[model samples]
Target: MINASGVLRTPRQTLFWRVTNCAGAQDSARIFRVEKYFSPYTPIKSRKSMNKGEFVESLADRLDVSRAQADRALSAVLDIVAEQLAKGEKIAFTGFGSFEVSKRAARTGRNPQTGATIEIAASSVPKFTAGATLKAAVNGK
Candidate 1:
């Protein structure tokens, strides 16, 4: 609800947080309300996915390197992984994970739209199995 001062008010909290410089507005501090409960639409904190650019920027900042260098390093790592996987070789980083190519056999499958049978051709795809350290890190251990 909008209060008399044009600030959003939430029924659960009598005191609201004041935020300035919102959306380039030059008015006084405004209050933005937050939900008291979580809904399905609310974002999950544990599984937020970072985009490639953001990841690269963060890596650069952490390593004290330029973004260009970080980008090149990231690309080289990905290229090497792709090359190894293409050769049916596995790439392993002891505490991180391993990446390899796996084969899928051709099989008959059903078409969901028309309820018809379909054939799935055999192919090879890259797969990654996380190592113990990575698993522990993800689980907040």
Candidate 2:
């Protein structure tokens, strides 16, 4: 990408090759850049985030079950949690987390663009509180 207006941008480990342009002129020299990837097994990915598919696969491996079974188990657990929260009930898994509904109060908010006053309605939102064991595990204790 061209950047900084006056300066040119080049990525790390970028390979530059010169080729002859045939369409515009006879054997006109043109430069091109090729990007190189360090990983040979898989493309670059973030380890911070795990998608549903990966989670299901991991669950299946750990539980010694099929992917479909693991996915169904996960879906059922999520459905139960959501159902409990919707019913105004708190579901607490000891040493893991607690799921509950949070009540938000109605308040007046100002519109940033027009500087106008707006009435914001109150709502119930789902909240999760991590338990001691979960927090400790995250902290690498």
Provide the TM-score for each candidate, comma-separated. Answer: 0.68, 0.66
Clashing pairs in 2: none
Q: What lDDT is reached at residue 138 by model 2? A: 89
Give candidate 1's TM-score: 0.68
* Winning model by TM-score: 1
lDDT digits (tens) for residues 72-113 of candidate 1: 999999999899899999999998999999999999999999
lDDT, candidate 2, 45-126, per-residue tens: 3345779998999999899999999999999999999889999999999999999999999999999999999999999999
Each model's total of backbone clashes:
0, 0
The positional error of residue 48 in candidate 2, measured at the CA in angstroms, is 3.2
Candidate 1 overall lDDT versus native: 0.78
lDDT (Cα atoms) of all candidates against the true structure: 0.78, 0.77
What's the true lDDT of residue 137 in model 2? Answer: 94
Q: What TM-score number comes out for model 2?
A: 0.66
